[model samples]
Target: MHIVVVGLSHHTAPVEVRERLAFAPTAMEKPLHQMLALPAIAEALIVSTCNRVELYAASKEPDTAVATLRRFLADYHGVPLEEIEQNLYDYQGEEAIRHLFRVSSSLDSMIIGEPQILGQIKTAYGYAVEFRTAGLILNRFLHKAFSVAKRVRTETGIASSAVSVSFAAVELARKIFDRLDDKGVMIIGAGEMCELAARHFVSNGVTRVLVTNRTFERAEKLAAEFQGRAVPFEQFTDHLASVDIVLTSTGAPTFILGHRQMEEILRRRKNRPMFLIDIAVPRDVDPKVNNLDNVYLYDVDDLQGVVQANLKERQKEAHRAEAIVNEEIGQFHVWLANLEVKPTIVALRRRFEEITAQEVAKTFGNHKDLTDAQRKGIEAMANAIVNKLLHRPIALLKRTQNETGGEDYVDTVRELFDLPAPAVDETPLEPLDDDTDNR
Candidate 1:
């Protein structure tokens, strides 16, 4: 069987496409069980995140398995196959292994240095294991991916900076305030991006958070999730003077806070420093407000520039991480190639023993004059002959176990000896070039 990956990510598909194929965390068991029930799949793992939705599986026919998963994805989500197939990407064998390692190492992330993907993958793997959908190959493959991720994290500075816009905003906040431990933050919108930035501030030790939105209940819901207070929309600026940071991402067409409004607000607080991040596309705050003394305003483009600069820094370390993954892939491929070595030896021995027993039975039945003792001696001699004849070939196979084309050696031995091919529940991944006619 081959290790195959089939799915789409933020790189290949937009959010709408990804969402259609997404698997909810709480609803994984049924789909996992269904995946294992497919003919081509042996072991299965599904990773669904905001940025990607991918299915990894072990199967004898990589193409067939990929097709099966593609159909499964559309059918399960009640989406038309045409809608998702165009966005899907697939990999097989060594390439599949490389893709998974890159994903675990965060090099495949939309934001290269972002660290959330590794944990998300781990959680997905946990679900597979819990549901018993992940068998031998997948369990081993995911474990290797995790170890590679750990190595990348410790050995490279890939995740050293803020790669996401929300995170960049937080880093800038830290830079201005020296520390966020006692800083007050006010979020003027309850949108996803706004909430993410607020959560980052809270996580980074912001002392307080106050959320406000056009719909006051949405503000209340988001504020409760972050363990913060919710301020009414009209009265939100009443506490703006008290906050050291402001994040706004509302959909309002006009500016919510103007330069004139901020001038009065700044006076009430004695021109204290305030960091304002306008992540909204429509511009939540008036551009002229930026000129106010002690007020630093940054829009989405500025935050993206920070993210871009950090991404460039991360790109430098990505080479080191890629090298680590390449090294690990070689090690894993060796282990995978060797899976057939021992099983083939055992099957070959069993085949020889079976041949000897059948021949002995035929000879004993024909020669009725032979004594029981003589028959026993003949059987012992036959067993020794079979063992001695097979010893050299078995030893040679073991010695060359780490060499490429070890499967070739096994296949040749089976064909020369006319032995039945070793049976396996799931095939370990093999490079497609070396994957022909092993059976």
Candidate 2:
């Protein structure tokens, strides 16, 4: 059987197209079973996330399977095939293996090194298992993919640093405060960035959160989500001294907090250090506030600069990850090649042994006068001859299994020996000891 993947990712399709094609996890069983019902599909798994939708399958006829999957995706989603056909890509055999490893390792993500894709793949594999769509090849393939991802994470620093602006701001906060357990965070707006940064702070051990927005109700709604207190927009400065970290993203054209107001707030706190982030387009905090003693101020551009630098660092680490993926692909290819040739090897050996036994028995029948010891010696000689004659061909089959025309080589040998091709087994394999956790 051949491994194949057919799908569209963020690189090939827009969110609107992806969302339409995506399969809900709760509803996966039906589609997975449907995919397995197709003529060429033996095992199937679907991975659907915000950025991509893909189907991974094991098939005897991969080219036919790819075409069938494209039609299945369009028909299943009630979409016109022409609408999505151009976006669909298919990879078979080794290329399919490479694509899966890269995806599991997060190298194929829009933001390389992001960890969510790995978990998403794991969840998708779980659905395949629960629905009985993953057979031996897919089960082993996914487990191998997971191990490759883990190795990439451990050997390289791809996910070691913050690359998003909101997370980068939190990283900056950690550098200034050293420990956030005793620190309080104050968000000056109800914007998405402010909410995300606040979440990052809270997750990083910030104990208190204060929220204030021009719309008091919005502030209260956001504060309730974080279990924080909502302060009135007009009286926000009154609560400033109590907060060590402040994230501001309001719509005010002029600076909301000026140099003089921060000086007073500093004095109220006995000149304690403060971290101020101004992510607003119009500049919420005064640029001059950065000059104040014990105050670390950053604007949108500053945070973006940090994000860009970290992204560059991540790109460097991604090169290392790519190398790891390449190395893993070779290893997986060897295993897959062995799997493909195993049946042929068994049949070849069985054919030779059968011929050896038949010729030896015929000789014994022709010489009935021979002693029992002589017959045993003749049988032993025949067995040794069969082993010696079959050794070279078997070794050749194993060694050439991963090369081009490997399947043709196996077929030719089977035909030359008049050995019938073995039937493909569809049974699921027992779980390996190492893959027991579904990690």
The candidate that wins on TM-score is 2
Clashing pairs in 2: none
Q: Could you give candidate 1's per-residue lDDT for residues 347-375 as a string of tens digits?
A: 88888888999999998999989998999
Candidate with the greatest lDDT versus the true structure: 2
The 10-residue segment with the lowest total lDDT in model 2: 430-439
Model 1: pairs clashing at backbone N, Cα or C within 3 Å: 1-427
TM-score of each: 0.65, 0.85
Off by over 4 Å in 2: 75-83, 189-192, 210-242, 249-253, 260-272, 418-439
The TM-score obtained by model 2 is 0.85
